[model samples]
Target: MRIGLDIGGTKIDAVAVAPTGQTVDRVRVPTGFGAEQVVANTLQVIDALRGRTGTTPTAVGIGIPGLIDHETGWVRHAVNLGLSEVALGPLVAEHVGLPVQVENDVNVAALGAAQAMHLDGAHAYLNIGTGLAAGIVVDRRLWRGARGNAGEVGHIPVLADGPPCVCGQRGCLETVASGSALAAAWPGHPGTTATEVFDSADAGDPAATAVRDRFVAGVASAVRILVVTVDVDSVVIGGGLAALGERLLLPLRADFDEAARSSPFVASLGLSSRVLLAPLDQPLAALGAAHLAPESAVTTA
Candidate 1:
């Protein structure tokens, strides 16, 4: 059996998958902030998942939400978690009495999305949650890029003088398109979440509607970047805003269509139809983690 864990900002999800690609057990627990608590919570979930199956996991994979060094097995930086540098692989392996593989959560989710959806040829998984990023898969193989930061599109500048990003840059895609950005831009109600912003737009609130429109444009821009740069066979959309479902897709599709109609170059790319929704039936990152072991069938390479 192989075990996979997705350590996110709000929750820790775990799953055990048999050699046949069937999940035998799964568990979820609230994520603890900071390094020590996060590790403890992750270990707890692993133990619980193992206990449910009454079998030892042959390999374990963990998806972390930050900058990770594949060679050093250390998390270089996790801005949201306030984690600077930590040896997550060694610590988890020591506690679990087994070897562990660690990778960025979005990258693993891309792997999971590709496997679950059985995408062919080149594919990209766009994660528009608290931040914006993408994971690329070429010919069913993951392309992590040099330094394992291949898909850091959130920092890509889109607007010349838009909002500021945590990375100390102005007009980054993350500042305009991510869930965090939506919440930050919401002017109708204080502490309103991204989902509520979508809801407010549905209710016909002008301010909320404007924010929603801007968000849609930003997201459409992100999609265009992937379509033009990599021209993947498919682009899978996932992450927190996914819960908005059709409300999100409608505007995104509209924006893409508008762009295509105006520019023959855009229409030839066929970017609108290439965009797809990621499967939400399972925790993608965790499932991708299950396939992370070097010897596992779902290899990232």
Candidate 2:
């Protein structure tokens, strides 16, 4: 058996997958702060999942939010998670009596999405959630930088002098294009989430329409950077904001179509449909963590 955990800002989900990669048991629990509680919750879920099956998993993997240092299993920093400098992998491994592999939540999802596409060799996966992040894959492997922090498409500067981002940067793609940005831009509106913004956009409200358009432009602007910087043939867009479907993608495609006319990098390459939805069900982070576990049967190259 293979155990996979998806650790998030507020919740932790764990699943036991059979050797064939089919989920056989699952458990969900609220995530606690600090190193001790996080591991406790994870153990709680793992024990429950294992209890249901009365079998020990061969290995465990986790897809975790925030910036994780893959080499040392240290969480360098993650504001939303209220954690920094916590060594996660060794702690979990020691506590659970199993080998543990950790991966960035976004990168895991990207890998899972790419695996679904069968587009090995090279690809880029962008996930637009509370914020924006991308996962770059090189020849079927995740390209983590020295600190395991790569594919951070959110921090790239987009607007010269725009609103301040939670990351302490101004005019970042995430501040303008992410679900949090949409929720912030229209606080007085009836709804409190990105889904509400889409309903308003679909209803043709002017303020909502303006907010939607600006966010889409930010997305397009970011994609332009990703496509040029990484030179990937396909870009997959997923996460909470992508639930808007064409509300986000159509405008982005139009923007890309117009911008590529003057761009050098994209002129020689074929961008596949500009934006494609990620196929990982129930979010990719935890599932991707499952993929990183030693027992995962990754499709062959």
Candidate 3:
């Protein structure tokens, strides 16, 4: 068996995958802050999976949010996790005595989405979370690009003087299209801000409708950029807002359809038809991490 863990800021979603790609066991634990605590919780989750499965895993994979050196499993500037720089892969491997692979969270999610959706050719996994970004997958393999910035689409400035982004940019796609953007536009929601905005819009609130429409337009722009630049076979939307399901997807598609009406270029691309949502039922990040295990260690049925 191979173990995979999706270590998020709030929780760690872990799984044990058999060679045939079946999940043997899964576990979840609250993530700890700081490097030490994060590493400790990761080990604890691995132990829990092993105890439940009653078998030792040959290799382990971790999908985490950060700037990662995938070759060495080194993590840098994982602000949410309170990690500055750490040899996460080595530390975990030393304790568990297994070869470990660490990769960016979105990248792993892309891999999982490809496998789950049975997608072939090229595709992009667009994550619309607190920030916006994408993961590129071609023929089931990740394309990190030369500097590992292949899918950093969120930072691409759209409006010349819109809002200041955390990346020190003005009017980035993320500034207008992400969870943080929704929170800024529709604050004071105890629950999900995106849900609240959509609900208020559905009730015909002009302010809320404006916010929703702008956010949807920004998302549609992101999809257009991905398709036009990479020409991916499809763009799968995932992340916290995706929980809104068809409520979110229908508007995005509608935006594309509206644009298609004006521009033959947009119509030719079939932008509306090429967009999709990631499977809500699966822990895509953890599943994708499993695929990062050494090929020789993976067993197929």
Candidate 4:
């Protein structure tokens, strides 16, 4: 068995995967802030999973947000977790006595999403959560570019003069399309802003409709960018807002269809047909983390 952990801003989801790619056991624990606390919590989850499964895992894999040196398993600029620069992999491995590998959260999610969706060939997992970004997977393996920024599509400037982004840029696709963007456009319901925006738009609220339309347009633009850039086999939409399901998918597809009618190039790409929703039922990040473990370390029956 191999252990995989998805360390998020809120919690750490841990799982043990059998050699056959089945999850044998799973556990969740609150995530901690800062390097020390985060490391401690991660170890705690590993211990918890071991106790639950009553078996020693061969290797450990971690998926976390922020910039990471995949080769070194070093994490940097993880502001949300209060980690500036930490050798997360080496520390975890020293403590647990198991080989460990770390990767960007979105990359791991792309790996997991591909496995869950049974996608072969090139695909992109477009994460539309608090921000917008994508993870590219080609032939079931992550394609992290030379600098590990292959899928930072969110920072692409779409509007010449638009709202500023946290990345110190103006008119970024993220500023117009992400969960944060939806919350900023339709505030007051901190927890349910996306739902509120879509629901109100459905009721014909002009203001809400405008927000929804702009958000959908930004998303459609992202889809187009991914399809044209990598020409991936498909783009799977996932993240918190994806819970909106067809409410989000329908409009996004309509936008694509409408654009296709005007642009033959767009029609030939079949952007609408290539778009898909990630499976909501599985823990993609954790599963993908498991897959990150070296094949040699996976134990067979």
Whichever of 1 and 4 has more TM-score, that candidate is: 4
Model 2 segments beyond 4 Å from truth?
78-82, 189-191, 260-268, 272-274, 293-301
Off by over 4 Å in 4: 293-301
Candidate 4 C-alpha lDDT tens digits along 178-264: 999999998887869999999899999999999999999999999999999899989999988889899989999999999999999
| Deviating ranges (above 4 Å) for candidate 3 | 293-301
Question: lDDT at 245 for candidate 3?
Answer: 88
RMSD of each: 3.2, 4.3, 3.1, 3.0
RMSD value for candidate 4: 3.0
Give one digit per residue, the lDDT tens place, for model 3 in 229-282.
999999999988888889989999999999889999999999988999999999
Per-residue error at 247 for model 2, in Å? 2.4
Alpha-carbon shift of residue 52 in model 2 (angstroms): 3.1
lDDT of 2 by residue, 1-301 (tens): 8788888878998877777756777788998887778878878888888889899887777778777766556677766667788777777777777777777888877766665566676677888888898898776567776655567889877779988987798988899888888888988543356767767888989888888888888777667677778777678888767777766677778777766688755555544374676763654555556667363322112
TM-scores for every candidate against the unseen true structure: 0.89, 0.84, 0.95, 0.95
- How much does candidate 1 score in TM-score? 0.89
Alpha-carbon shift of residue 214 in model 1 (angstroms): 1.2
lDDT of all predictions:
0.83, 0.74, 0.90, 0.90
Report the poorest 10 consecutive residues by lDDT, candidate 4. Answer: 292-301
List ranges where model 1 is wrong by over 4 Å.
79-82, 188-192, 293-301
